[model samples]
Target chain A: MRDFRVLLWLRWRQFSDGLVYWMRVLGYNPKSSGFFEKLYPLYLLIISSFWVFAMWGFGHDNAVNIGSNIHPTSLADLLKAIPPAVLILQVFVIIVALRSTPLKLSFADMSYIAGSPIARSVPVLLGFLRQVIFRLVIIAGFFSLFALVLTRPLAQNIDLSASVRAMLACIPLVVLTWALGWLLGILRLVYPGVSRWNYLWVLPLLILLAATYLPAPFLWPGQALVLLIYGIAPWWVYPFLALLAIGLVVAFVWFGNRINMILAVDESILHARVAALGLLAFRQPNLLLRIRLQSAAAGRKPFLSLPKVYGFQTLATRAALSYLRHPFMLIFSAVWGGVMAQAAVWIISNELPVQLWIGWLLVVGIAPPVGLLHVFRIDVEERFLRQFLLVDGLQLLMADVILPLIATIAGAMVVWLAQGFEPEITSIGALFIPILAILLALCGAVALTNKRVLQTRILATGITFGIIMVVGVNFSPIIAFVAAVLSIMTLGGMVSQNA
Target chain B: MADKSQEDGPLLKVADVSFKYGSLNALSNITLEASPGQLIALVGRNGAGKSTLLKCIAGWTQATSGEVHILGQSIKQNERFVREHVVLVPDTPPFYDELTAFEHLQFNAQVHGWQDWEDEAEELLRKYGLHANRNAFPFAFSRGMRYKLALCMALLIEPKILLLDEPLGPLDPVSADDLWEELNGHRNDGMTILLSSHQLPQEAHPDRYVIMEQGEIIAQGSPDGLRKSLHIEGPLSLDALLRSAIKSRKAVKADA
Candidate 1:
C-alpha cells in the first residue's frame, strides 16, 4: 500500500512537471506574481462552478426521478434518458483524461522517461493511473452532485431502493463508456485522421441499448427478489446484475489496455514516417519555396511578393495556393456540400415551409467562414507570416486580415448559391452584409489582437452559438446582420487592443 | 583487405544502403566502413549525399535497402542500442521551442535517470560560458548560442559515437576552441566521431578524409596520406585537398 501511494505521488509529480514544462514553452508562467497569475486560480474556480451548476441544472429533474413514478413504457425512452446523461458524463471524463494524459506522456517527456534505468512499466502504469484518477474525480463529482440533489425528490414517489439500484446499475455503464472514450483518444495519437470518427461509435451503442428489452426479473434475479419483497422489483436480480457489471468493467479495462498498446505502436511508426518525409523534402528548393510562401501567408501577412508577381497578387496567389494544399478545406467542403444538398432535397420534398430553409442558410453560411478560420490559424501558429515580412518588403498586417476576408466572401457565395438564389437579386445584396461583417470581424481581430485573433474568434463564436441555442432565437436576416456587425466590432476591438 | 572478419570491429558499416525520396534516389548502392575510434571527415559538396549517409548511420533516416551496422549490430535490429550508443547533432538542431538550457538539462537528467547530473550539467554550462543565459529560451539566443546548447545536449547524452553535420557552422572562434577541446576530450575517451563540414579547422586533425562528388566517394585516405599521394605540400587543409582531388578526378575522367 505504501509503495502504491509512493508510485501515485511520483506519477502525479511527473505529470505536473511535464505540464509545467509545456506551459513554460507556450510562454505561460502561472506561478508568476502577476495580476493575471493571481486571478488564474479564481478564474478556474469560476469556470468549474459554472460547469457544475449548468450540468446540475440540466440534469436535476431526470436524476431525482430516475425509475420511480414515470415508469418507462418503452425501451427507447429508457435508453434515451439514461444514455444522454451517461454520454455527457462520459464525454466530460474523456476530455479530462485526454487533456491530462498528453502532458504526462508527450513524446518529449516519454523520450526522457524511456531513457531512465527504471522499469519501463513504471512510467506507463503511472501515466495511466494519473489519467484514470483525473477522469474518476470528474465523474464522481458529477454523480455525487446528481445523487445528492435528486435523491430526496425522487424517493418521495418511487421505491427509493429501486431508484438507488438503477443509479448503481449505471456505474458500470459509465465506466464502459469511459473506457471506450479513452481507447478512442489513444487511437487519435496513432491515427489522427480517425479521431473525428469517434462519434460514430455512440449511435450504435445507443441503438443496441434501445433494442434491449430484458426485464429486471431476468436481468437481475437477486435484486428483483429483494425489490419484490421491498416493493421495488424483486430481490433475486441483485447478485446477477452485480456479477454482470463486474464482467463489463473487466472487459472495459482489457479493451482499454489493448487500445493503448495498438496506438503506441502506431504512433511510433507514424512519427518515423513523418520524420523521414521531412528529411527527404528538406532539400527540394521548389518545395521549400512553396512551404516558405505558404507559411508566410498564413502568418497573417496582407501581402507577399514573388520575384515575378507584385503587390496583392503575390499575397493572394500565396493564399490561394495554401488553400489549395490544405486537406481540411477539402474535407469541410465535401461534407458541408453533401449535408446541405441532402437537407435541401429533404426540405423541398417535405414542404416544411419556407422558414426552415433560413436555418439551413444560417448553418451553411457559417460553415465556410469557420473552416477558413481553421486554415488561417494554422498559418498563424506556424509563424509563416514572419518569413514573408523579410522577403516581400511589405507589411503583412493587412494581408492576414484580407486573406480570410476573401475566403469568407467565397464561402458566403457558395452558401448563397446553395440556397438557390432565395429573395432573388435583393438577397444577393443582403448576402454582402454578412460577408462584409465577417470580413470586418476578421480584420479587427487580426489587426487588433495580432497574435490571439484566431483563439479569440473561436471563443467568441462558441459564446455566440451558446447564446443562440439557450435563447431559442428564430433565424432572421436582420438578426444575421446584427450578429455580423457585433462580431466585427468585437473582433476589431480585441485586435485594436493587442495592437 | 575487407575480408578481415576476426580482427578489430569496424566502428561503422553501411552495406548496400539505398535511400529514396519517392522515385528520386538520395543514396544508392553505397558501401562504407570506418575503424574504431577513428575520426572520419565526410567531405562532399551540397546535395552530394553526405548528410543522408550521416543520417542513415545515426538511425534518423532508415535505409531503403541493405543495412547500417554500428559496432557490428544492425541499426534496424536494435534502434534503442543505436540511440544509446550513437547521437546525431544535426546541422539545424531540433530544439524544444520553450525549454531553457537549465530546464533541458534537467529533462535530460530525468530521462537518462542520472540523479546527480544536475550538478554536472550546471558545471558544464558554466564551463561552456552558457551559465549566465541558462534560463533563457533557445529562441532568444543567437545562432552560435543555439549551437552551444545543442552541443551541451549532445555532451550530456555521452554517446559512444557522435555524428555531426556542419557542427561548427554557427560557432565563434572562442566557442570553436572550446568545442575542439571538448572533441579532444571525447577522442581521448575513444568515442568514434563522424562529421561533415565545408569549412574544416586546422586543429581537428581528422584521421581520414573521404572526398565525395556527384554522389560517389572519389578519394579516401588520411589527410597526410592524400597530400603525399598527390604530391601536395605538408599539412594541407581538408577543403583545399578536396578541391584538388575533385579537379584531378575531373582531369582524369576527361583524359579517359
Candidate 2:
C-alpha cells in the first residue's frame, strides 16, 4: 500500500510537470514564435466555447425529434430487443479493450519502483488500477455520450423517467464489461490456462442472439440472464456492477502477486511507450511507426532488393518496397483510405448540422486512430533529407507519394465500385479519387516541408481535404481532376531546393 | 589566378555562419576553415555550438545568416555540390528498423548510384567485427555497434569531407583507436575529417584543435600553440589547456 502511494505520488508529479510544459507550449513558447504564438491559446478557447454550445444545441435538437411512434409494435418486444443488442455491444467493446497489455511504467518508475523493497504485487496492482481507471473512462465517456444523445429519441415513445433510468443502466453494464475485459486480460498473464476461457464471453452473447429466433432450451439460461439484467432489473444493476468491479480488482491483485516482475517489465516497457504515444498519435503520426519499430524484434535482417532502374525510379521502387516488406503495412494504408472514403461519403450524404459533428469527429479522429495518411511518415523517418539531398526535391517527393497513392486509389476504387450501381457522370464516386489524390499530395507536402507540429498541420490539412473531397464527390469529374492538378502544382510551391 | 572553384582550394570554410533557434543563437558568427588532409577536433562544453557549426557546414541546417562554402562555393545555393562532397554523422545515428545492417549499407550504396559496393561493405563490416550480424537490424545492437554501422555507411559513401558530431563518445577505447587509425588513413588520402567532442581521445592528437566557448571559437591551434596561448607555464594535457582557456576567457569577461 505504501509503495502504491509512492507510485501514485510519482505519477502526480510527472503529470504536473507535463501540465506546466504544455501550458508553456500552448500559452506561448516565446522561443518558438514571435507574437503569433500567443494568440493560439485564445483562438483555441473561442473555438472550444462555440463547440460546446453547438453540441448542447445538437443535444436539444436530438431530444426534440426522437422516437415519434412506429418503431416497436409492443413494449415486450422493445424490452427483449435491449438484451441482445447490449450483449453484442459488449463483444465489440471487449475487442477494443484488449488492444495491448502492459505494466505501464516509464523508465523512472522502473528505477524507483523496481529498486524499492515493496512487494512486487504493488506495481502490478498499480498497473491494473491505472489501466482500469483509464479504460472505464474511455468506454463510459464514449458510450454514455452516445446514450445521452440517443435517449432523447427514446423518451418520446416511452415514459420519460423509466426511459432515462433504463438508458442510465448502460453505465453499470459498461462497467461490468470493463471488469470482465481486464479480469480476462490479467488472468491470461498470471494463468495462461485461463486465456482460452476469454473466448467464452462471446458464447453467452451468441446463445442470446440464437435464442431470439430459435426455440433452444439449452440457450434459455444465457438469454434469461441478459434479459433479467438489461430489461427487468435496471434499477439494481449499479450495486451489482460495483461488486463486480471490486471483485475484479481483488482478482487482478492476487494474480499480480504470482506474476514475474522482470517478465512483465520486459513485456511492458515498449508497450508503455506505445500506449503513451497512442494518445498523441494524431498529432505525431511519425511517433506511431517509431514505437512500432522500437517494440518490434530486432532480428529483421531481410536483404533489400531494388530494381535496376537508373534514376529517381530506384528511390520510388525502394519506397514501394518499404511498404511491401513491412507486413500488413500496405493493408493498413488501404483500410485508412477506405475509412476516409466512408467518412467523406457520410459528410456528403448527411444534411443535418448535428450529423456534421459526428462527421467532423470521424474525419479528425481518423488521422491518429485509423492512422489515416501515415504513408507520409516514411519521409519524416530515416533522416531522409540528409540521406537523399542530392536527389531532386520533386522526384523525392514523387517517390514518397507512390505507396500512399496506390493504397488510397485502390481504396477509393473499392468505394467507387460499391457506389457504381447508379453511376451518373455527376454522381460517380471516381470523381472523388482526384480530390483524394490532392489531399494525399497535401499530406506528403506538409510532412516533407515542415519540421515542427506536423500532427497539427496534417490534421488541419486532412480535415480540410476531407471537406473538399466531400464537396468534390458532388461535382463533375473534369472539375475534380482540374482541382487535383492545381493542388499538385500547389505541392510544388511547398517544396524547395533545400526541402 | 588559379581557379579556386577547381578542386584545389580549402576543403571546408564557414564564413560568418550563424544559426539561431528562435531568439537564442546556437552558432554565432562562427568562422572556421579546414584544408584537405587536416584532422580538426572541435572541443567545447555541451551547448557550445560545435554540432550546430558542423551541421551548417554539412548543409544539414541552413544558417540564419552568412554562408558556408565547400570547395569555394556557397553550400546554401549549391546543396548538391556540398552534399556530394560532405556528410554529417549526427550524434545518434538513425536506422530504418525495417532494414538490416547489410541492407542499410546496400541501400546507401545503391541510392548513391554505386553499382558494386558489396566488397567495400563487406570489408567495413569485417573491420568492425559486425560481419557476423550483418543481416540483423541495428536497433538491438550496442551503442558501439550502432556507431560502427553509421561509420561504415559514411565510409562507403566516401565523402571528401566527413563531419562527425561527438563520434568518440559511444566508441570503446580499442574501437576508438581503430577509428582514428582509419581516419589517419583517410587523412593520408586527403579527406578532411571534422570531429566534435567534449573531451579529447587518449594518445590521439588531432592536427588542429578548435576550442569553442558559448557559440564562438575562443581559440584554435596545435597542442603546443594552445599551451602558449593560454599562458600555461608548463606542458599540459589538452584537457588542462582547454580548461585554462575557458577560465582565462571567463575572468576576462568578468573583469570587463
Best candidate, TM-score: 2
Kindly give the stretch of ten consecutive residues in candidate 1 chain B with the minimal lDDT sum: B1-10
TM-score for all models, in order of appearance: 0.37, 0.76
CA deviation > 4 Å runs, candidate 1? A1-499, B1-8
Per-residue CA lDDT of model 2 for A107-129, tens digit only, reads 66666775667776677766656
CAPRI quality band, candidate 2: acceptable
Relative to the true interface, what fraction of contacts does candidate 2 keep? 0.26
Q: What are the per-model DockQ values?
A: 0.01, 0.30
Interface RMSD of each: 18.5, 2.8
- Model 2: colliding residue pairs: A66-A153, A283-A455
TM-score of chain A of 1: 0.42
Local distance difference test, each candidate: 0.55, 0.65
Which regions in candidate 2 have their CA more than 4 angstroms from the true location?
A: A1-130, A148-167, A192-262, A273-285, A298-314, A324-328, A354-378, A381-385, A425-427, A451-477, A496-498, B1-4, B202-205, B221-236, B240-256
